[model samples]
Target: MTKSAEIETIAADWLRRREEPEWSSADQVALDQWLKLSTAHQAAYWRLEHGWRIADRIGALGPEISRPFSLAASLQTRWKRSRTAAVAAVVFALVAGSALWFHQRSDDVVATASFVTPVGGRGSIPLADGSRIELNTDTRLHTSVSKSERKVWLDQGEAYFDVAHRADEPFVVYAGTQTITVLGTKFSVRRDGDMVQVAVLEGRVRIDKDEGIERPRPAIVSRGDIALSRGEATLVTAHALGRVEDGLAWRDGRLVFDRMTIADAAAEFNRYSRIHIVIVDPVVADIRIGGSFQASNVDAFVRLLEDAYGLDVRREDSSIIISAG
Candidate 1:
């Protein structure tokens, strides 16, 4: 078996052992030590354990959501379906609510929703499990929250997630090539067409790409990692804690830029406002700019461009056209 597979096997074994009546606190300590040995161990355990929770919570939220399934007097519940995801196998157990073992290919889901934030506006969604999603401007998002799994699709734009940890249930976000598995992490995902960016602020998240999707530059991201995914390419890099905070300045109504190109800044601002900062000249577009600006104050940004940077700025309708003075 491959290294990853071996780790998963060990994780499954640990999960099974913990259900034993004889399992003690020392065993739990040992399991914790093993998980800390590698990020792979954590990911493996999270996925496998996520599977075991499915039988208890197959349906979506409603009055029946709290109701649990009774497998049988003797046998355990089996998986509902299989998916073509890259997973080799996911172990599940319920021998007697904590005993039998089997493998499942995917999550059992019932609830689904789709929502969006208007251009230049923000919105928040609270799930039944106490997890919350904050959407950025012009964002389209779809969600499925089954009893055992929470999945989100960022069809376009950006969103911030403050997840409540349910170790048994996995919280996953899909954006471009990113198949992000969250263990109660606070992070933001942004999708601009074919490119996707994930900036993590708290806790760690696993980013795995789908097999049939575009090939990615594989990366093992840790806490505070910035993961960017595009067609046939992905880049993962770590940042200081503060840089991660700055990346989330939008939550506080601020835009922080450090030596960002004029064109790039314009695109970032365009996401938060209807006013367009149009720069057609290569010279003006290539000039690097920096500083913190209010996300909604495009007029202040325009005045800065014209007065401070000595650039010619003309307003025509909704477009603020910039050129070299």
Candidate 2:
């Protein structure tokens, strides 16, 4: 690496350590001395330090990206895995999320989300390749299109993708610890605190973890299947195709509830809306919720709760309180 590159990389490592909140006073003193060694060192250090801080801020607010289509979609029309320039392009597309977010904003808001698609504000983007992306509310994706491959890094929340086939490039979406690759596929990706849920509505896709420590075990999912990945990239479980379709029903603005808990249903609702739902009684949380409700109509859901089970819905400061009558 060049001298500047070396300095920047070193500073980045140290900054990462500093973020741990466990750095000793001696470590802090050492960092101060390193910063004072020369003007070049200080400048480079500040640049990287600022970069790390911005990344942390954005991470705290959730991923500052809109989940785009899978990389596999753009690379090949037929979805035959070719580990060539396509992988490089996919990696580049992965970074495109952060790149678009950075380039579009003034340096002042470099790490902050200037605007977020609020809950219930559904938007769609049509790519040059005829792929369509339906972004849910509170979803943030840095939008940019390029020749190599279409890429969008899903920073947070959920988005449904219907990718247009591109033989030379793959349409890929990266979220948290998981990466979803697809070609001419329809799917929904939900990125929660530490888990990523992927359901394929059409076509075949590969779900892999973002780890090189050990090559990930691949989970090949066809249409009508769901894959849940937790902890690491290791597959936890793959459910039946019908179950996958039920969980991914939100793409069509409908939610399919099959013996799910009220608490779990509320959690799912929270994903598409900013409004919070709190089940005051733990017992109420366990109550079975079935049938479909308009994903955006939380009020109707509240009314449904009242009518179906004689429960009460009271609004309290941005939170819907659910209590038994």
Candidate 3:
């Protein structure tokens, strides 16, 4: 193997050893020397370091080991002690910046540029960057992975991303006209008709207008917050962390509704199924319903609407029309 390839390989090995609680002092010293040999060595080591951090968050390397090792009992104690100096030198190469990266790249060359999931269809896509995207029905997304950034544009529907961290590059997802930017964070974004909603399951995300402005951005969504943009402004509602996942859990064929009006509730149900719901009675349409329902059974949901509120249902083509009894 070439020198750079050998360095990358050794760095990967050091990461494996670091994850284990039992690391001999000799191994530590060798790792220190490997890290200091050249700039490429340091860069490779830091790449492994960031991988460890992101892996820990996703529980990739197994359980956390808080056990401490003492340098006083080893042959390479002096070498391991000197390795602390390399930390500062490696920061630039290892750390991912917060700036957003955008590019006008085509998604061609791979099968097709984009694909749409029909109603009741769900599938997982493995991106070139090792990140995985779970796409829900009636969804369309265009993906382009580049050396500087990873971006996916969601034209419509919902998708959950378990993003892989790339320290040298930033990952950006464009849903509707808004851009959701992150270095490495787990989140879901959905575009419903004219509305766009973003829920962060882990880490953090930046939501901003398509056209950049020099002014301070409106909001940075962290865990437990739902950012919904209608037209002019984005509304952030603090919700239970569990509900945030449940809201995006439609990828698992589950639908969750919490104190939502019939009109809003019907809209959600319509997205996943072929049978759409139309509310004819304004009064009944405004009534709030709260509960969890399976997305597969549209007939059962129609039955629930009839059972809960005394409403008459009319089936027309592909939609169910509801009116006051």
Q: Write the per-residue lDDT of candidate 2 for residues 155-259, one digit (tens) a residue.
A: 777778888877867777777777778877888887766688888878978877765634447778777777777756544344467777777666667788999
Candidate 3, residue 52: Cα displacement in angstroms equals 33
After superposition on all CA atoms, how large is the RMSD of candidate 3?
16.2
| lDDT (C-alpha) at residue 120 in model 2 | 56
Top candidate on TM-score is 1
Candidates in order have lDDT scores of: 0.68, 0.63, 0.65
Report how far residue 287 has shifted in candidate 3, in Å: 1.8
lDDT by residue (tens digit), candidate 3, 85-142? 1222122112211111122336321111354667876655544344667778778776
The candidate with the higher TM-score, 1 or 2, is 1
| Order of quality (lDDT) | 1, 3, 2
Model 1 residue 293 lDDT score: 95
TM-scores for all predictions: 0.65, 0.61, 0.62
- Model 1, residue 190: distance off in Å is 0.7
For model 1, the stretches where C-alpha displacement exceeds 4 angstroms are 1-62, 66-109, 211-218
Candidate 3 backbone collisions, by pair: none
